[model samples]
Target: MEIRLFQLLVPGVALLFIAAVAVRYLKGKINLSEFLLSLIFWMGLGVFAIFPDNISVFVAKLFGIKDNVNAVLFLSIGVIVYLLFKLYAEIKENRRKLTLLTRKIALKDAEELDEL
Candidate 1:
């Protein structure tokens, strides 16, 4: 087994970085800052996954497993990831509609309401 310098930078740290972005995404916090962070997090994590080290190990631990657990962990993580995106999309769509409806009502313009 050969340990490389790049391995140290990736693995657990990188995946944790990805999880933070994903968490922010799931929370409907998709601003420019969030998007940029998510992009960087995923890109770095993706690049890191290529090496295979602590990330796989950390994921494996989720299943109360010791080895060869990447398959299960990966699937579970994928489902959660899919659900997170779906949630984000639904929330974003709702916010868009709310903004449009609120604009129509002119809640901020008290004079407009007086005419109704």
Candidate 2:
């Protein structure tokens, strides 16, 4: 078995970072869903970093990609795009809620002023 520096280095750093995030989640700095999703993502990253060939080859075969690296690249881009859309939706919802709350407050203030 070949011991590659990258395989060790990447996993080691990722594990440490994941641990820190887990602690923050426990302390209530982050939500449960976010923590769980991040944990799963980091663990998968560690596994793939250690055995990239396995995942790349599997993906390439499944997707009919000519190269394993291309398979990995394509999958990564897809994940990023999905995450971006999710974030956009969350931001839009938050903006809508904020607008509703501001309107309610303004109406209340106007009513109070009329009473005065």
Candidate 3:
């Protein structure tokens, strides 16, 4: 199949997502493994980005994987799962902090009442 503009978009999307994750983690001050894994991911994305669709199809066949579209789709699922877990953990931590703060405020209020 001829590589059309629409086909090129598959790799572009992957690269964009990789960029977002990289920026987010960097801003969060995460180190080492995260950066390395992101670098590897960006490499795969770069393969798809720098080369045409035919190259990906050839490599995918050699690797016993699916076509470029399916490969991108599958890769996206992993990103989605990671984001979901990250969001869940963030929400849980925020809730814990909120609860702790609420308890502290209530205790302080109770102390003030006792003093009055």
Candidate 4:
């Protein structure tokens, strides 16, 4: 079995990200759920990088995919779409909150001016 340069490099990068996430978590910069999610993602990335072929083959078989490449592509697309949906939802909630806050502030200012 021949080891490739990327197999080592990718895992090394993943470890660096994991360490960064741990430090942020310890410093209370991110919540517990965020920390755990980051940890799991980084760990999985490192493991997948180290065993891409084996994992891809397993995924292909598990999903009844005819080709490993196609399986990976589909999996990657699914993850991206899920993340996008989550981001969109967060943004929508933020916008709703901002609108409510703005309205409250505007009403308070109007009342103060009228009192003068």
Candidate 5:
């Protein structure tokens, strides 16, 4: 089997990220679920990079895609959309919390001024 530069480089980078995530989890910076999810993602990335053609072909068949390239593209876009949705939801929640906190502070300040 022929080894490509990207096959080596991608796995190396994935390993680094996996180690970082493990360290973070050990330090209590991330929960078990986050660590496991990150571990799975990085391992899958490394495996995919190492055997791109084989994995892509499998994915294509599984998704009933005619072409492997198209299958990869479709999967990538789906993941990106999901992440975007999650980010948007988090941002909306943060905005709502901030608005409530601001109103509470404003009411407290107004009450203090009325006393003065």
Candidate 6:
């Protein structure tokens, strides 16, 4: 229960991840939603990792879970599912846009050929 190393390590890693996300967002590589999601995730992770006992016990009790570890696991699974869904949506949108762009380019090329 007393993970001393993680007490320091987790927050450090979380901060690094947050910084990376911020940098990407500022560079215009990622959108606002993506930035916010990543920021919230890392901040939550850092908070939970830093104060596992305090928060975990409350969450476990709230869910009627006997074990704090189980509560943490449940929340982690939920977060993973949410992120996966978001990723799927982004991929689907990108695919749709790419298909539309390809069709447009092909039509333009065909029109040019017909003119020639």
lDDT of 1: 0.69
- Top candidate, metric lDDT: 5
Could you tell me how far off, in angstroms, the CA of residue 9 lies in candidate 5 after the best superposition? 0.8
lDDT of 5 by residue, 1-116 (tens): 89999999999999999999999999999999989988998999999999999999999999899999999999899878977997899899999999999999999999989943
lDDT of 4 by residue, 1-116 (tens): 68999899989999999999999999999999989988888888889889999999999999999999998899899878978997999999999999999999999998999953
lDDT of each: 0.69, 0.92, 0.74, 0.92, 0.95, 0.92
Q: Where does candidate 3 stray beyond 4 Å? A: 1-48, 52-63
Candidate 4: regions farther than 4 A off? none
Model 3 C-alpha lDDT per residue in residues 19-97, reported as the tens digit of each score: 7778878798667687777767766766656565666577567667867766656657878898799789999999999
Which numbered prediction scores highest in TM-score against the true structure? 4
Candidate 6 stretches greater than 4 Å from native: 1-3
Rank by TM-score, descending?
4, 5, 6, 2, 3, 1
Question: Candidate 6 lDDT (Cα, whole model)?
Answer: 0.92
On lDDT, the stronger of 1 and 5 is 5
- In order of listing, the candidates' clash counts read 0, 0, 0, 0, 0, 0
User: What order do you get sorting by lDDT, best first?
Assistant: 5, 6, 2, 4, 3, 1
TM-scores for every predicted model = 0.37, 0.79, 0.54, 0.88, 0.86, 0.84
Error of 5 at 53 (Å): 0.5
Off by over 4 Å in 1: 1-32, 61-64, 71-115
